[model samples]
Target: MKNTFEELKIAKSILKSLDDIGFKVPTPIQQKAIPKINSGGNLVGIAQTGTGKTAAYLLPLLTRLQKPEGNDPRVVILVPTRELAIQVGEDIAELTTYSELRHAAVFGGIGWTKHAELVEPGIDIIVATPGRLWDLYQEGVLRLKKVKHLVIDEADRMLDMGFMPQLKQLQEIIPARRQNLLFSATFSPAIEKLAEEFLDFYDKLEVAPSATTVSQVTQTAYKVPNYRTKLNLIRYLLEDEEKFTRVVIFVKTKEHAEGVFKVIQRKAEGEKRILHSNKAQNTRINAIQAFKSGDVRILITTDVSARGMDVSMVSHVINFDLPRDYDDYVHRIGRTARAGNKGDAITLIDPADEWHWKNILKLIRKDIELLPLPEEVEVLETEFGENQDQLREIDRQRKIDDPTFQGAFHQKKRKGSNKRSFDDKFSRSKERQKRKKRRKL
Candidate 1:
């Protein structure tokens, strides 16, 4: 049975806020985690992104904050990145409009003075990135002793990016008797082990497993030979005229993201926006806002924007480069096809990424249909051996390196003396010539 938002037993002010926002029913994550949080028990919620995990924690925490019995900053949510910090802050702000809760978000890439100015006189809630929160705590601008609720969002991403140390430091300072909530899209073994330290007899809630993808997203892939060919394929897809109207492209690194953006802009008509780690905080925020407002039709981003972004109108998602972590694929594609809308997720696979390509299939546990590249897109690859004898020889070499070889083959030794040298001769000659010229001078 579907649970209604009013049945969650939240405070009247928060209920009115939910009505104002037209939140009729609780999402899966919200339905599970809200009850656990309201019970005053620590919880570990393993849910997918865009599953309303933010509201799962926010609604209950807001209700507790308005208890009027005790005061001091009652809630602290530690996120993985600055962008996520700002995103969560905005989501929480939207829900807290009708209440008297004072909240502030602290993150890097902004002035220290600004954060200090915001932290004064004790806020009811704080959303912060780990590093920036650590800095503020060290400077004595915030007090943790009175904190009643401690929430850690994106736990796996936090551990992946080496925020565990900072998170541990925070645990040492905050009050021991606080409600704890840990939310993550995917949880690794390391994170599962770490949960033992923070949560107390916690309720483990998982709406979906680690490898699940949204049902509304249609996943497809294209096999190309190299990066250049993949770029051409993206241009072709964008110019298809009927397939896409608004699209978000995900790449692996910041440099590749910008390069893809530049290539698309050079080939594509109309305006395009790029979102990566290099841009200023305001610029990144503006690009997201523009994309959400329908002013910008295309957004090129890295894994920085992969988690917890709730833009509902994206029509297409392009995986320009597959993420190393397969779980990220699910989050990247969830950007589109939201709110019962249909969307498509397309991936460009190059020859060099054969290993990474298999990982996606393994994660999805389903074979992805490979679409033939458009005729205008050229695939460049060197054919090793097409003839019978050459192909046999190549197979022989493959057996020697293959993991299943098992000492199966024996070959004759070479006749000549082997020159197994570590150093390059050309580099040695260049260095010697430069030294001799210096001596002559």
Candidate 2:
């Protein structure tokens, strides 16, 4: 295994930057992916988030590009979210600080003028979200004819967010003879198909089993009775300021995000921010900056919006609502236990969420130990919360799929038959009709 960044034969300038950042020993993904990427061959890296996959591709690419040569970006990194684009841009900027490399990060949610200004001058590398990149390309502000290297970060996420069309459009834009690299925490079938189309005979490398959480994170679940109890638990846990100093709470939807934010805002003091799709871009950016600067102690966000968060020192990651997509569980916990730091992932599982929690366990293919709530946590009722919301949604869907299927919730139960009275009445009516037909015959 390649133990040190220096052992990778990177330039002294880049090595000094890595030293400054305390990135000495290579993580599993970096160790295997670095050398192969340096060889200029197509590669697909399968690893979890916080495993240093970004540096695995970036370090090698940086070493290869000695200096900025032309106006068009020679290297391009496409991410699904604006937040990830910013994070990759920051990573590249830090690494290239010791050397002479100009990089630009471009994405939507900002004015077109800002992105045009960044691309007007030559850029060695460009990190961007796909939509904005395509937009700039259409506007004649961006070009890929000179792109020598192309990297797609979070390939599975791009598919989840429905970026395949933009990616396909990019297929027609980029130079055919470029070095390609795709990295994902897990490889779903969609990612597989995309990789096949994007790469030309790439090497497949797996640092760990697919969908596995990092070993450093101590993951555990709590059997909370309901949403109010979850709120109480959050208050109780954050009460220990020393242990839960830097925390990120993950919810499922913007509505739920708002609800959780309101409760936590009322119960807790100190700097806390909420992130979702609806908030202004500046608001989201400021929230993350504050969280990273340690100014914000609590950051409540939706999984879709939080994908770009690369915070390493988060003390705890609490799942306010389990993701409907089980794969997201890996990414949620990944926000903590980063950069060789030990952290905790506490998931509050309600009765309805128990089924999803089981799928998460099965998907990760391991047993995350369950911890009994502190003898002090308040037990709550199941009258409201995401569980109720989910039930209501399922009923709505059932109505669409089968009009006659009254949902488990909508039909009242019969006293003796233990069946829905509506169904029982329908059955008796059919029986009476059959008896009347026999008597007439």
lDDT (10s digit) by residue, model 1, range 381-436:
53543234334544564574685653323454677548545476677878999999
lDDT of 2 by residue, 1-441 (tens): 778888887878899999899888988888899999988899999999999999999999999998879889999999999899999999988998889899999999988779989998888899999989888898998888999999999998999999998999997999999999999999888778888999969999999989999999999888887778888888888878888989999988888788777877867777889999999988998899899999999999998789889998999999988888888999999999999999999999876677678778889988988888897887866775666786876676567668888886786866676655898889999999999999999
Instruction: State the weakest 10-residue window (summed lDDT) of model 1.
Output: 382-391
lDDT of each: 0.80, 0.88
- Deviating ranges (above 4 Å) for candidate 2: 384-441
**Evaluated with TM-score, which candidate comes out highest?**
2
lDDT of 1 at 344: 92
lDDT of 1 at 174: 91
TM-score against native, each model: 0.85, 0.89
Candidate 1 Cα outliers beyond 4 Å, as residue runs: 67-71, 305-308, 380-441
Residue 363, candidate 1: Cα error in Å is 2.0
